[model samples]
Target chain A: MITDRIAVDIKVPNQTRYLCLIGHIGENIARTLRNYSGDREKLAYDLNLVLTEAMANAIQHANEGDPDKEVHIEISIISQRLIIRVFDFGEGFDFKQYVRPGHPLDEHGRGIYLMHSIMDEISYQQTESGHVLKMIKDL
Target chain B: MNLQIEDKGAAVLMAVQEERLDAHNSGELKNHMLKLFEEGKNNLVVDLQAVRFVDSSGLGALVSGFKNASSRNGNLKLSGLQLQVKSMFELTRLHRVFEIYTDSDEALASFQQ
Candidate 1:
């Protein structure tokens, strides 16, 4: 029997103190795959940077600055792909479609645009649970 | 996050040595930058040669700091960004937002009229 699937789930209390946990997640998972195969290190680095940015956006903006809400993350490594799902119990914005040209004069509204630029596939959906962002990349 | 400031008459350089600038340290950086403005130190240069990554919140903090400086007759600049950290600006198109230089010396020299 070959085991090729892994999942990491966490429920953040929607506070700044908990934000640091997000930065370590992708790296930790990637570290665990040292002997597995493929460019696990690069995948982990990418996941770490992109996921932290996405989660930071959720914690800061999507919740309307609410710190009592719930933030959930689901990270799974299956076959040659890594899947990341970040959801929040707050109003969501349409970020995947936002585009700001490489202008050196604008400062805000670039998080989602960058996320899509880095992720291989990104999507969003609204549910009773609030707004969910699903992102996938091949490692 | 740690900051060291140097005032050069026409420009003030802020050297930042932080690994991650997400929500964890974004607020602190914001407060510090604001304090610089309070002291009338306006020519701001953020040294990110050590920061490997930055998130939206971190970027937001930088943006907020720049606005504050701009409102006070000063400017904010960036220096020594790694490829990873530099990409944040490219991805978000924020490379257009800051006066980015390769280092503090370069950024300081540019203040010449």
Candidate 2:
């Protein structure tokens, strides 16, 4: 029989002010998982950077800075992998339709791309309530 | 984020005095840069030595500043990027967009040559 492995779960109001809090949480998670992964500093830095992009999208785009909305985050460790999920309760965009900003001067579109570059795997799923962004890193 | 501005003969150097640049304060940096452009100072050097971390929003602020400076025939260059901050720039492919230097002196000197 296989059992689910749950690590950390948190929900915060959809406010840009909470971004730093998310960063701290991500750093802590990375540090905790470093014991398993044996890459403390790099993993912590990567997670910190990825969380900023993910939470920014949720706070700015998905929830549209609506204070009443909530952003859910879940972290799990399983099978030598660390998984993170960010859930937003708002209309979600199609990730497959995304295109890298053609021009180097483009300012606003690099968040998702940055997320993909650092994480081992990334995918998106639309939930009944809103959407879920799943990211995995090898431990 | 706090910014310290210094007038160095050829270019104005704006040093980011914060340790982290994120959504909470990126807008402040953007607005400050735009304000400098409005004041008729064009050649800009942003010193990021103290900024250890930057997210997409922070990068966006810098891009906006670059565009604003370019619109007025001015230039915006970057210097003193920490390892993680430099990695963020490369990951976003923004390294192609801005001229980055290892130190503020080199970045400031580029404006002359």
Give per-residue CA lDDT, model 2, range A1-116, as digits (tens): 34335588889888888888888777877666534536676677788878877887887878778899999988788866778899998877767544344466777777787788
Separate DockQ for every predicted complex: 0.48, 0.71
Off by over 4 Å in 2: A1-6, A34-39, A99-101
Q: Write the per-residue lDDT of candidate 1 for residues A1-139, one digit (tens) a residue.
A: 4645888899988776766677678877777763456666555556777777677767776787687787899988787577899998788876744544433444556666666767898887787968888889776
Where does the lowest 10-residue lDDT sum fall in candidate 2 chain A? Answer: A94-103
Docking class of 1: acceptable
Native RMSD of candidate 2 (Å)? 2.8
Q: Write the per-residue lDDT of candidate 2 for residues B1-113, one digit (tens) a residue.
A: 58899989788999999988888899999988888888899889999999978888889899999999999999999999998788878777888889999999999999888
Q: What is the TM-score of each candidate against the true structure?
A: 0.82, 0.91
Interface RMSD of 2: 1.4
* Model 2: per-residue Cα lDDT at residue A118: 80
The model with the greatest DockQ is: 2
